[model samples]
Target: MLDIKFIRENVDLVKRVVKNKQLDISIVDSVLKIDEKKRKLIGEVEELRGLKNKYASEKNIEKGKETKLKLQELEPRLSEVEKEFLAAIYKIPNIVSSDTPIGKDESENKVIRSWGTPKEFKFTPKDHLELGTKLGIIDTELAGRVVGTRFTYLFGDAVLLQNSLYQFALEVLLKKGFIPVLPPLFINPDVYTKMARLSPETEIERYAIERDNQYLIGSAEHTLGPMHMGETLNEKALPLRYFAFTPAFRREAGSYGKDTKGILRQHQFDKLEMESFSTPEQGLVEQDFFVSIQEELMQALEIPYQVVAICTGDMGGPDFRQMDIESWMPGQGKYRETHTSDYMTDYQSRRLNTRVKTKNGVEFVHMNDATAFAMGRTIIAILENYQNEDGSINVPSVLQKWMGKSKIQTK
Candidate 1:
């Protein structure tokens, strides 16, 4: 959530951000009005409490009783107003960086650069689904029958490939000083709310274990981010980096009839996510470094991909700036999103109460989360890019050691 003081001082600018993000502009007015009322009520409550204490000290029982009654009346209202104020303020999105494009949606996202060239296949390239089926490595049809759509079972080399992806990413991140963690798959609703990704508006995108009062995490960062919630870190730990491997669950709500045939859009998928907390001044640079690591991983796989700067409306409310890596999918005849890096600045830290003690004072730390690899999508990219004419899939050279075979073919 944005600091209320910042919102008050830059009302116009905040409103512009709301408009650019395609949110209700009137939320600014609502939040300001509620803040004014809340502050007034707080003052009245404090004043009444002071009077009650003063009267009691002076042995004026009747006056003290009246003041106490007034306090009781106002305190409940103050509590209500405070809740209302928080709800309103949380609606305000983080201000986007000046360099971020001010466009409405993904269509307006700018492609910053690209790496590698899409291979020219000698035969008609098969999509990952067809290749996986022919190789007897992926079975969505059986998974769908057992668990419904957007689910799949990986057999044989496909499972090995996924594990290899995780191992490769973990090694890369470990050498870069990132601590690897296996975070909880479930999160308390309150903590999840403070993470600010799953709001009342987007809660449907996540799985809720209603009985347990917990929500299944849609990403590893969801759990990794709040590790130091409500704590202050020493400034010397300026950039605390971590990478987590977890099975992510998503409802895929409202995403029907899209990528319905493959593991590209699944209800359950494994991912390796990179998350970090840094001093404010180093936030943007930290994000760039994360993107660089993402590029390094993709390049090592020899997959052609482009870097895209996500437009305002295309990014999440907590993202001050966002970028994605879209790898070339020859089977799909287009580039598809395989990795994303988000620089949330202090937007998330402010809510999580995750702060850093600096030379000056304690302040909210900036947060960043990016994809090391979304196993399913990366696998799709590899399958399509490295498929042989006779329906075999050559493993990426880097993963060959782990797989112990250069190619995977039908038994």
Candidate 2:
């Protein structure tokens, strides 16, 4: 949610964001009208309270009773208007950063840089599903029967490989001064809404535990971001960095018939996510560092990848600026998204009420969250990129120590 003052002063700019990001233009008008009503009601209520206090001080019982009656009538109206104002304001999306490319959808996204080269294979490469099935490590057919489509079971070396990826990413993040965390998998809808992860457009993609009124998180960042909600921190702790590994759930509601053959798009997947709170001056730089770290991880795995600048339409509503890393998938003969970095500035912090006390004054902290590894997708990249002519998968050298072997093959 944006500050109402900012919206009022920059109505045209906000409307431009709505148009560029493909949101309803009328939302701005609706919010401003409701804001005006709410402010008027607040002024009335305050004036009545002052009158009531003055009567009490003067011992004017008859006048005090009349003032109290007016106060009762106006207070409830003010409360109702406040709620209406909040609902309307929440619909306004964050302002887009000047550097973000204005475009429509993913196809318009620009590829800024690329690393490594796609390896030439002696034999025809197989997709991760085929390779994992042949190696007897993935059992999606049974998973489908037991739990429905878009679920899978990992056995033997596949499980080991997943753990190795988790540990490898954790070590790298730890070296970068990030504290490790294990966050709750479930979040209350109210907090989730404040984080801007829950909205009508995204409701279909989320899993709601209606009985408990909690929603299953789609990313660790969802839980990690609100750790300091409604709190103030010292400026010296300006950039508090944390990372978490969690099993994320998604409905894949609108993604019918897409990546349906493999774990590439699953209802349940594991991920390592990095989140940080920084002073406004350091926000964009923090995002740059995150993307650099993502590139470092991919390069260490010796996988080919490209860095993409996510266009306006393709970026998240809360993201002021965004970038993604797409890894080469040889079997698919193209690059697929494996990681993303979002610099939200103060958009999320403003809603979460996570503030920082600066030397000059208090202000909302800028927030950044990025994918350290989307385990399933990264695993797919590794399998497709490192497959052997004889159906073996060579473990990335960095993960080999934890995997305890250089290659994964049928026993």
Candidate 3:
């Protein structure tokens, strides 16, 4: 959410951003109108409060009663106006950075650079889904019977491979001074709403356990973000970095028939995610650092990949800037997105009330969240890229130690 004052002062600029982000500009206008009414009501209420104070001080019962009555009526009106103002403003998106590219969708995203070369296979390479099935490692049919579609049951070596991916990512993040956390997988709707833009418009994208009145986390960031909710931190704790490995759930709502064959788009998957709270000036640097870390991890795994800058319409609502890491899938014969990093400069903190108190003053802390490894996608990348002609999957050199074997072959 943007500051209403900033929106009011820069209406034209805000309107331009709204259009660029493909949001409704009328939301800005609505907020301004509500803000104006709210301010007017506040002034009237303050005057009435002053008069009531004066009447009481002078022992004038009649005027004091009348003033109190006026305040009672005006205060409720002020509350309603304030609610309207907040509702309108919350719909507005964060101001995009000037350097952010302008594009309509992911198709228009700019590729910054690529690393490694896609492997050339003398024999046809099998997709991960086929390889997993042949090796008895992944079963979607069983998952469908057990749960529903868009789910997978990782068997034998596949489970070990995912664990290896998690440990490998943990080693990299730990070296960078990130604290490891196992956040709650279930978050109350209120906290989730404040940490994320979970309006009725996009609520279908989330999974809610109606019986428990809680929502399962779509990503570890959703849980990590609210750790400091409504709390103030010391300046020395700036740039607090955290990483979590958790099972993330999503409804995959409205995404039918897309990547439906494999673990690429699943109802439940494990992910190692990184979240950071930094001083305003350090937010972008922290995000860049995360991107570098992601690149390093991918390079270590020896996967061919590219980094792409997300455009306005494709970026998330709270993102000031976003970047995605796409890994080469040999079976697909293309690069598919495996990771994304978002720099939400104080956009989430403002609503979470996660702040830092310095000698200068207090202000909302900037936040960045990025994927270290979406384990299922990482598994796909590894399986497809490292497959041998005989249908065995070679483990990345870095993960071989934990995986206990160089290659996984059918039993």
Candidate 4:
């Protein structure tokens, strides 16, 4: 949702971004052409309206009737042209930051830094699935029968552990000046459209309730991002941070045979998400702050992880820049993505009509959303990293109090 003026002035840069992001370059040309027609029609409509007004003042019935006919024809044509122009413009993605890396996919993503060290196990480690099953904490077999694949029911300590993770994440964000919110799990199609900038491809990934005309939210950010839709906020409240926990549902379309065993890629999962609204100058800072918060959470958990700068092609259309925090999972013998931060600039705000009244006048607010914790994946990291040789799971010190025990073990 870039400003058309910016797109018009920085055509070359926009083209380069489209190329780097693997988007349709022809869309840029289409937008310009449609906009040209739209502008011309608008001018013609205005001129005809003016003539109609003059004819009325002069009491010229014949001229007035002709002008009225011209206005009716031009107005509808202008409306059609305007619709085409808007559709074309929406197809254009936001310009990437100058510093954003140019690459085709995740393989080229740059790891800016890493924290902690991968643990060395003297004995073979079992994945979360095995550990949970042995400890009678996770039941996937029953869930498969009840809800189909990629679903699981946590029993006993696993339930406590997941809830503890939620509490811990909420506390961390609350201390950082973020207001906690519990948004509706179901959102109207209109709000979701603006929040996600729904294109045909993305629309397929959502779970739509056809009868209700609502879609299930895929993340807390989905709802949080549109909280101020079509509103103008006071600049004095520059940065409004919200932390939310929600049960997100997704169709998981096109993602088959990947992490299907565990809760990593589930049709339904819980997540703690952070969303913020800030002035343009503060967007990047807010992004960095979110990454810092992520790092802090990872460090507190004492898990090995890395911070990656997402390449152009790997980023979402609305993301100006993005980063992912991948935590080590010993059972999987690799690092798995646990959190992501997307700096959308004004891409989302423009569609949401979320603006702020600043000294310079009203302007679209820069929006950012990041995962504080994906509960299921975070639990996977915890289960794999904190497992003892004897099949007991040692709770992270920070969560021990909430769990009321230091270890989860079978009786």
Model 4's TM-score against the true structure: 0.98
- Please write out the lDDT profile of model 3 over residues 335-410, one tens digit for every residue: 9999999999988999899999876699899999999999999999999999999999988999999999998999
- In candidate 3, position 51 carries an lDDT of 94
TM-score of each: 0.99, 0.98, 0.98, 0.98
Give me the runs in candidate 4 sitting further than 4 Å from their true place.
Answer: none
* Reference-based lDDT, each prediction: 0.93, 0.93, 0.91, 0.90
Poorest 10 consecutive residues of model 1 by lDDT?
252-261
Candidate 3: minimum summed lDDT over ten consecutive residues — where?
193-202
Error of 2 at 310 (Å): 0.8
After superposition on all C-alphas, the RMSD of every candidate to the true structure, in Å, is 0.8, 1.0, 1.0, 1.1
TM-score of 2: 0.98
| Candidate 4 lDDT score at position 36 | 83
